[model samples]
Target: MKNIMNKTATVMAVHRERYELLAENHMFYGKLKTADFYNVNERVEFPTVGDEVEILFNETGDSLITKVLPRKSVFMRQTMGLPDQAVAANFDYVFITMSLNRDFHISKLERYLTVAWQSGGTPVIVLTKADLCEDRGRYLEQIYEAAPGVDVFCISSLTGEGIPEMEHFFAEGRTMVMLGSSGVGKSSFVNTLMGKEEMATGGIREADAQGRHTTTHRQCMFLPKEIVLPSGERIMGGGRIIDTPGMRKLIVSEVEEGLKSSFEDIEELAACCKFSDCTHKSEPGCAIRRALEDGTLSEKRWKTYQDMLREEAFSKERKKAMMKKIGKARKEIKAKRG
Candidate 1:
């Protein structure tokens, strides 16, 4: 029953009924106290990985999580057909890693860009396993065509090629989160950055570029002190990195600014349409339609934008319905009490 409160800490990992937190240069196990449960409107409140929380530790028992601080950003996706659940939080950059081999797909990259933009973090496109791919330039061109104005890098963990360029993002006080499907060499990349095999790596099918998912849980690791870049530049306390288990589906949720940011070119083109409410499907004087017709816009990219818009709309509706159900349930409980 430690009454002292406001012990700020960062959530490193979340497990069933238990949480791992980093506070005051130490790690501690914590559990959510009953009083910490939020009100009805916040029925979904819980600390996800990277959340900064206030806690109180009992010497002879596990720490009690008193509060979950507001998150600067959250990476979440729908789980098991349920509402979106957070995967990580408070990351400054999202490393959207994808292998340059058979796993490369323009549509998948677009989906990741949408989710990264929606997560309120800067998205960096990292094309891994460059050694396996011959025409890196082709994939680079496709990346720019799909996600314009985002930083893109092609790196090989085996040969240390292009690994030095990533050092700029690892400045102190910054955090980066790796996101992609399994077999993208995310762990390998981290190991290369760490100068050792901090994470386990698995073999992938050389044909399809698929591999067994090696990372079983989401965890954060601090970069080594005084990291030396391949360019011979030394940087101290080079930020933090969180490795998450590869996800299969990245279903986006209610994203207005994210959609606009991810598809800025499309939105700008739509602004010039003859009708303010033009859907760009079959409308006359549609700038987007003209762009698609004239090869100014890739049809595949346009379709990806449209698909994300539909998904965002659906997510918004789903959230509204869930909130309605929660409100009704609260009212019923109040009536019963009365």
Candidate 2:
């Protein structure tokens, strides 16, 4: 085995213990070093799609990944009965995709925005299946109200409507990660952006309009500089796009900053309350209560914000408890060795 040390590569895909790496335009398979990653006292940061890593390259076989480089941004979600899972890393933008049909829910969008903002990447709302929605004005209005100061694009991947307006985000070297539930047209949007049918498209259930999982794994693809569409239109693309499997559950934890940013209006109102401890429930001089009474803040939005806070608190406690258990296990192992 010819070994080349300290070569850098980007993780393009991950499947359990195996990884597909891209380095200097060449693809190589990689596996983690057990000593460096698995047999450590502290928790190891596993490689994810879009992560830059140091590898001991092998010309004939799987390379040994030595270290995962620091990520500029990481998108993660909590998994029940397991640790927090990293979805993607080092992305510049998070495309929060949702369909305009039955799959669209304002509460879901708000939840996505909170996590997207917390990922250290700018969030851009991508509303897909415009061709299916006859009246999009109301939906757009709701989105604008919920996500002020964030960019939003409404596009139909089938017809290419609103596709041209999103070309600016595809500038060279920028990376975007698609985040949404299944059947949100993420694959279709990727194909359109690539100006070809590179990803498989699946149909949603007619009864509920939920999508089937067509993309099973997370993979990154480099976009060409120029993509010519079938409609004789061309898109200038030079960035990278990571397409991930649809997440069935997106649980947010330790997202205080994200919550504040997503619900800035509510935050500001709370700050204006007469008492810092005011709970907004039958409390005198509660700004939140006043806003609710006057209709400045919709009851539904306020309730969603509160629900997220409760969930976050619960998740944090669970994580703390899990960490304690892990620490105890490590101590027992050390005692045995001694």
Best by lDDT: 2
TM agreement with the true structure for every prediction: 0.91, 0.96
List where candidate 2 sits over 4 angstroms from the true fold: 1-4
Instruction: Check candidate 1 and list the clashing pairs.
Output: none
> What is residue 85's positional error in candidate 2, in angstroms?
1.3
lDDT of 2: 0.90
RMSD of 1: 2.6
Put down candidate 2 lDDT per residue, 208-303, tens digits, no spaces. Answer: 877788888898888879866546688899999999888887899898989999999999999999999888898789999999999999999999
Off by over 4 Å in 1: 38-41, 205-208, 228-237, 332-338
Q: Give the per-residue lDDT of model 1 (tens digit) for 1-338.
A: 54565588888888787888889898889998766575543564588888998888765678888788888988987864355688899999999999998888888888888889989899999999888899888888888988888999898888768877777798779999999999898998888777777888898767766667898778788898776544455555568888887887777777677888888998999999999999888989999999999999989888888888888788787788877877798899778888
- Report the CA-based lDDT of candidate 1 relative to the real structure: 0.84
